[model samples]
Target: MAILSSLRRRSAAISVAAVAGAATVGVCLTVGSASAGTVSGSLYRDPSSAVVRWVAANPGDSRAAVIRDKIASQPQARWFANFNISTAQSEAAAYVGAANAAQQIPVLSVYQITNRDCGGASAGGAPDLNQYQTWVSNFARGLGSQTVLIILETDSLALLTCLNSSEINARNQAISTATRTIKAANPNAKVYLDAGHSTWNSAGETANRLRAAGVQYADGFFSNVSNYNSTSNEANFGRAVISALNGMGLTGKRQVIDTSRNGGASGDWCGDDNTDRRIGMYPTTNTGDNNIDAYLWVKPPGEADGCRYTAGSFQPDLAFSLANGAPNPPNTTPPTTTPPTTTPPTTTPPTTTPPTTTPPTTTPPTTTPPTTPPNTTPPAGDGCYASVAVNQWAGGFTANVTVTAGKSDINGWTVTIALPSGTSVTGTWNAQASGTSGNVQFTNLSYNGRILGRQSTTFGFQGTGTGPGVTATCVG
Candidate 1:
């Protein structure tokens, strides 16, 4: 098996009626490649309010221990401090304290200056630019040793329709000022200007808006902030935005995305049951891509974004459901595992046959067919010793092969093949393989002894395969 490649599917908005009415549906979905980074965090916490609720609900409940353990175990998940800080100085001090104590990065949502959507479907932000900057400067002061990930005022730059040029300019100025203040306060802080999501903005429009808002002042922009679109589509949109940013001369900047609540892309923009989504990948290490940094679980899975479910409350059941817990089922597509096909060998006869005149002189004629040369390489579907596909098994498979002297052993080799579509690994060996809640793990295999100088060892398994889709590679 070779290194599994990332598959990305763009989420194109299609009408449900059209899909349901079709005789056959061709679903092209991409699987995200396994990455090595972690970002853990709760959506928001109202210390005075949440602490009381937690204590009241968990009195003598063993589940509390489980919850605490789960949260503590994932150190990469940062704790987001999201509350209205009345004064800039106080808010800054509080965040600084939290960062110092946690020894983990803190993700903050700067919301007070804006209308915050507290009363209506789309609320406005501060009418006064001075007040907004004053608040931002205070917010910036809280930087400690720990880094801060600032999601500057969600949808402020987005709701452009409602605001006049003056209002929009004020908004832009506020964001620019906030970014500068924060950076000055903590040079290490990563500030991502919010870009709503793919459904909300076209690539060209987003780039224009980002540039107008002085995007260069901030580290980069963010997308899918609080929406339910698959990571695939978000990634695609992010790439487009990056291109647009580059067009504006802001090259080499990187953006982060909110992968929270989008286990799958939403069917509709608003109120669609499908829009109520779950989470996928967590905050990851820098992607190393020039334009994209990380895919983060910004919105804690299952939290309501004023979805009328519980009026800005966290619905555990809903959260779990989106997390593939209940109601909404998890995607059970199997990993890909099929090998490429090989062509058969061809045969040809000698250019000239013996003349019939020779037959007159000879007493008897002897004809012999030409022999085909042996194929040194392993044939397709043979599962030969030289090249074994490791991820063919359902869960994960491992085998051991011996190598003679003068041969190089391919042992101590590990291959992680993606299971084919509609199938999954039910079991594994040499180590334990487990598949729970849509995640699969393979471990603990032994491969020992060197092959003779030229010999080789091989191990592999055959499980399921997936996708009619090709692998996705990073362009740059």
Candidate 2:
């Protein structure tokens, strides 16, 4: 397979539902009898991911719903590729901190090793081994005490052919030091060195390179990070590498496979423009394998691999394709509308569980503003229209309001949402907010202010109390 472009490297509130799924099963690694057993745990889902941002910016696209539910909702590794040594610590801290708040483990990929990607399309990193080591140290220092998984320097070992013997030695030494630095900073953090994919290197050779690059200091090794390889094949390769590592006295190491885009494996490893590749298994600690640590989405799907578009940029159509092609793609069938009922039901089942007795004075009635199906379009008028999708829990809810311009393009727009009596906005993204509750106005940010004719942009907010039955009104 062409591995030249394979190594390209590229939240959220504490939901009670999410925190309940944060329990991770520990696996004891043994050389013999490494059965395919998945562990159990919830990976952190970043609300600010590229797909989420895209979904928020273009909610009116026909494929938005599928992409939103499939790709944007999964947990993927956030790559720390830019060689900004100074702000590395703070950036790492902020991301890990958010995951910590959510009671989930954060998966991070460090892609700035010196000589990364062998000067391929994804090339560029810290100037030298010394600088790379320093950057790694700073990034690790900010990981805090929470459990985090780190995929270290993708293709650093597998693509060693581009370097001279001296350069290879230097690169391995640098990775070794980086791994040690990360482990020393946060013992709770699990570091996995890159072992390339199954198609790139044989198990023994990959194990040898991983050992040389300090696999002994890491949790294990990660494979298929930016490639398209089936999970079963990658797992088998991982077991073989573990066997090799065990023979070399590096026992008890585990592996993580990038199940981001391996649903349909193809020989062409560059931009998957021609292939109909669907997203692989959803990210989780549950890989059902003793030797496999976790099945992660190392490469965020929909990102161009430097072929169809610029590398690392999100393409909505591509994202939708991957999502729609999944084995169990999100339901895209629109709900059929029936004629209006002559009389509203007197008693509707409660959308939320009722309190034992009298509810708190501040709590809104759970039955008020009955749960509406997602993608409900508001009444249209005034050269613009907006739609509301509400995801509600007992005491709180989140709303994604999509504002679309009419026949003419709009330079800017403001959306006024008349929230229910008891509802109040706590946080908002992709737009600026004016009011806390009723009659709240969200104005597009500078970047997302312009909407081409008939195009849409979305802004979301977390709210307290009941949701609004009213559709949002937009003005340019």
Candidate 3:
């Protein structure tokens, strides 16, 4: 079995020369920057992932190059599937702390529902709902106020067919309580409930189930976890579910789709040792679709699904096959226009004093076409507006700036922000930026520049210091 091969290589010490050469050549040859189409480069990549450890242990392996470039480098959710009630808090703290230190959003998957997997191959969870509730609270204690994305309990809602009516009610109530508990513990954590995949349930039925499981309290629902469904199908199904939720007076619910392992066939195949499957769109929050919040890898690509290996175990052969089968990486050509060339103001800023200039390295903007065309009609008032929402920690902060087209569509836009003193912008995603200190400028990338009338698009940045008095303005 592939697991045996992996275990054999686990203790081997790889030399420095092998690591450097593979890192350079493999990444350049196989994968480009995660900026085009569905992949966003902003999410956090776990340095010590299963695939990473595998690649490190077996640098000389034939399949190491492709797996290193493709699977190990990408950001995917880290699942907390064990029932470690006593150690949950510390474990959560260590993971979330690493992400916070790197100033990137962490994607966490909580899979300890009462009857996980319906006593199938991937069985065992909290003993009961009450214990599960306590486990959730303990886990939530470690999610400290940073921007985090939580995928709650895969198969919890969709696999309810096996449960009795009373059991179903109990599960839903537990989910509801867990949602509230996590949110209350860390307001910045974006919780998403599972809604199976596109082919599993009708859109209306899925929405009904989601609501019954307290979708009202969550940021949104996620679909296609550990399943091989196309992004388009899942996205369409998500919109239909949102429509159903809207009909139930549960408006403004967004959705995320798991693009992992869905790049190939969109069938009901699960736990099958199939080599035809491919990795889906790279994880990204800047999906260009308004209804879809992100395309995430809730299920890491290299891990087996209870077939060909033990469930949740990393298999290098499977990882290599999936990477080999993926479509060519998206073209990452820069937009025709250059980064903002406008000169910074020579005089003192109005809102806050300037800080030491530490400009972030510039990255070429992607040329992927926008998913939604801008409204051509002129607006009644201003062409666009911009707003800023900030989350701060001890010495750093992250801000999400939203640009809204007013009344009509906008062909392009430039947003300027006056950040508070002592703050310097360090990194950004979904948009190109110029000027790192007080009064920074952000311009729309080729794919996200155009927006429909009254619709909004978001871009975010990380900064070194607090930016409480930040103000932003948009010009279209």
Model 3's C-alpha root-mean-square deviation from the true structure amounts to 22.0
Please give the ranking of all candidate structures by lDDT, highest first, separated by commas. 2, 3, 1
User: Per-residue lDDT tens digits of candidate 2, residues 1-476?
Assistant: 23333332220001111111111111111111122533344577655555655565565678876776677666777777667889899889988998899677788877787666565555567886556766887898899986888888776776655675446545765676678678888988889997877876678778877876667778899998746778999989998999988886678999999888888765455543736678888776755578987878887887765556555566777787778857542233322222121321111000111011211122112222223443445335336677775645567666656778888888989888889888898877667999897799898887678877876666667778886654677888
Would you give me the overall lDDT of model 3? 0.66
After superposing candidate 2 on the true structure, give the runs of residues whose Cα lies further than 4 Å from its correct spot. 1-40, 329-476
- Candidate 3 lDDT, 190-296, residue by residue in tens: 89997877765667777767876777779889988745678998889998989988887677788888887777863324423667788888777777787777788
- Tens digits of per-residue lDDT, candidate 1, 360-403, equal 11110011111122213432331222322121112222222111
**CA lDDT, candidate 1, residue 460:** 17
Off by over 4 Å in 1: 1-56, 59-86, 115-119, 122-127, 266-276, 286-290, 326-476
Candidate 3: misplaced stretches above 4 Å? 1-41, 266-272, 325-476
lDDT score, candidate 1, position 293:
59
lDDT of each: 0.43, 0.66, 0.66
Q: Estimate the TM-score for candidate 1.
A: 0.52
